[model samples]
Target: MSDWGPVFVAVVLFILLTPGLLVQIPGKGRFIEFGNFQTSGASILVHSIIYFALMCIFLLAIGIHMYIGSYFFLNATVTPLASSSKSSENHFRQALLTFSNSKPTNTSFLSLTQIGKETTPSDRRGCCGVVFVEKWLLQRQDWRGQKMADWAPVLIGVVLFVLLQPGLLFQLPGHNRQLEFGSMKTNGKAIAIHTLIFFAIYAILILALHVHIYTG
Candidate 1:
């Protein structure tokens, strides 16, 4: 799994480095060229920064999902002592009482009470003896607001990813490697490759983010 992580990262990087895809902002009426096209030094720097920032965000999200998914998966498999014990007690009592009475009415009472007791509010409320009642109570207090709150993080992430330019993290490798606008040398081929990589990554992340925000 760990080996796969780095391999996946390399593949993503390679896709991002491929040349020649252009995107146009519909409302702005401007073309953002990708993949081996002639472009100004300033334009190259801005695009590079944007791509880098989006890549970092996508990596961070992947890390977070992995961590949270593991936690939930482990937690779900374990049973709590309190609930298990309570269930056994109810069953045993019902069995003993049913045999003792031997009447249909008494048998029905035992069955109803036993099942009801097992599933009562207090018994079914915790996760592996870890009490979630307080959390549940708190959520109820602002349930509507809490439901809508899910969109906030997704919205903010989308806004940041779109607004920021790619490749902000570092200068494009094999290029001039300079910090300033004039110092960097813009190779048409390299720029095109980088641009293509950026757009591909951008499209994938956006699709993933959309699925997450909507499905979650």
Candidate 2:
């Protein structure tokens, strides 16, 4: 099977397993009440940001792993050569020539060519072919920036949550009391739990991204 098959499957599974991404909007009976029983938009917005950020992280990890696994499978199935030593040597030389002569303008395009040319029998057959194999592997481009892009949403969400905390607190029905930074009235427990939740979600997102990118 091609690498894309497993990648597609993983992506679908990840999406299916994560439904919180779709639960951002307010629903019936899911309202946050402030003083005088008024609904708080700020509270809803803060919570939404937190949830969305977490969702982005989860998806990112899934993508990273999928790509990594796919690369492994492709590498394992590739055979260098099966003919006589001389013939294998000649083929390897030809394959190397083909790879060297081809100048890829972009990373993705170059990777496709490298994968196609290096996995063939001529270039990959014997134990001594390890160096060639490693060279081919190294030719693939890094997608770390892409992974970071996937994680950006989650980071933004965390920032938004922190910045809107004051408004969020005001929206709470019983938490209207404000405490000084050094005051004993501060609800450290609430703050801590909220921070922990965001971190946990971010971790999951990162894991998912790793899985997806690698497998793909």
Candidate 3:
């Protein structure tokens, strides 16, 4: 698989995890509704799932980028690039030194760096883990109010959530209510915890995958 295969999965995960896809604004008692049929609680659980999944997917992506960058760094030292030529060695050394002096910073508390970019590097790889993070989190620190284009991930997330809906149905067993899934009641706190656990499981799964790839 390519490096981005995992990323694609992560993106899908982000999209699926987008809250309010099936149920918008649960706080207002407005769940999934179509015509005279309506359903509740199912969307809350789904929204929770989405929130947690997004957190997990991004965390996993960060780890993968770091691991891949580390692999690249280790490979650079012993591979032909660094070992075969004095010029390459000098480049690697300079890159390393520069990286040491200007380490990357976390770009956003909500996320690591942007999905698929590294901000800076001493060599062509630049510092795989640092650049985007540095640029996003550190240099351009006003992350709370980014431009609309910058919110592409979030917007894409919403679209993905809508696309993942199983289908509209009127078979649910409530009075004039139809549901997307098994009926279940939830509150903000419960939904929050569910999302957290969802992301936690996802993070572990990706870490396992990362280990397999790294060792493979």
Candidate 4:
């Protein structure tokens, strides 16, 4: 996919997922709130989270992953050859163990400080690969390595949204105890359902297109 592909997808998601993106008043579609309705911070939080999850899913579907640090730029310009998505080097976790597996071992766990003090930088260099731990290995870009990467941000959003409820935290101007979009007054339930539907459609469309953010 082109560099602008991800950017375009991001913009499309923002428009579709943003609540009250289009608002109209004094028109045929104008809506009126029947109750002392208002959207709490919790509602907004939920919507935000839903948007995030959908974005991740969409990106994953399109093979768009965020490279850490300067990896993306360096890999693009510096690396002569693209690194394999798989790492074929020794396990970094084993190196961290700092113990023998074939012999008897101590059960005691080392503190972070002790580990930090014991850990020394590797003097090893790579031919064309990046040195992870002490070995020249490829960066992992496969789905297996990032199975739960989506959960971290989603969980944070979920927790905040849940707390936003009951008390209706962070009452802003537009959502002042009521939720309405354009001429259509809405509740959290409706918003949540529509968000899910939007996600489904976007996901299907992305799958149909089979777009990838990067090659190799």
TM-scores for every predicted model: 0.27, 0.27, 0.25, 0.27
Model 4 clashing residue pairs (backbone): 31-183, 37-177, 37-178, 38-177, 38-178, 39-178
* CA displacement after TM-score superposition, residue 2 of candidate 2 (Å): 26
lDDT of each: 0.35, 0.36, 0.35, 0.34
Cα lDDT over the full model 4 = 0.34
The residue ranges of model 4 lying beyond 4 angstroms of the native Cα positions read 1-18, 23-53, 67-69, 72-150, 160-167, 172-216
Looking at model 2, which ten-residue stretch has the lowest summed lDDT?
A: 105-114
RMSD of 4: 16.2
Summed over model 4, clashes come to: 6
Candidate 4 lDDT at 171 equals 23
User: Model 2, 83: alpha-carbon shift in Å?
Assistant: 2.4
Give the TM-score comparing model 1 with the true structure, all chains together. Answer: 0.27
For all the candidates, what are their Cα RMSDs to the real structure? 14.6, 13.5, 14.5, 16.2
Model 3 pairs in collision: 17-50, 107-137, 118-132, 119-131, 119-132, 120-127, 120-131, 121-126, 121-127
Candidate 1 least-lDDT 10 residues: 67-76
lDDT (10s digit) by residue, model 1, range 48-134: 455455545554454322211111111112232344657644544454444344422211221212223334354454322222212
lDDT of 4 by residue, 1-216 (tens): 112333445445544434443321122333422232333333345556766677567555544543222211111111211232122112333333442231112121211111122221231121223322211111223433433222322333233333322223222222344443332234445445444544444344433443333334
- At residue 199, candidate 3 shows an lDDT of 44
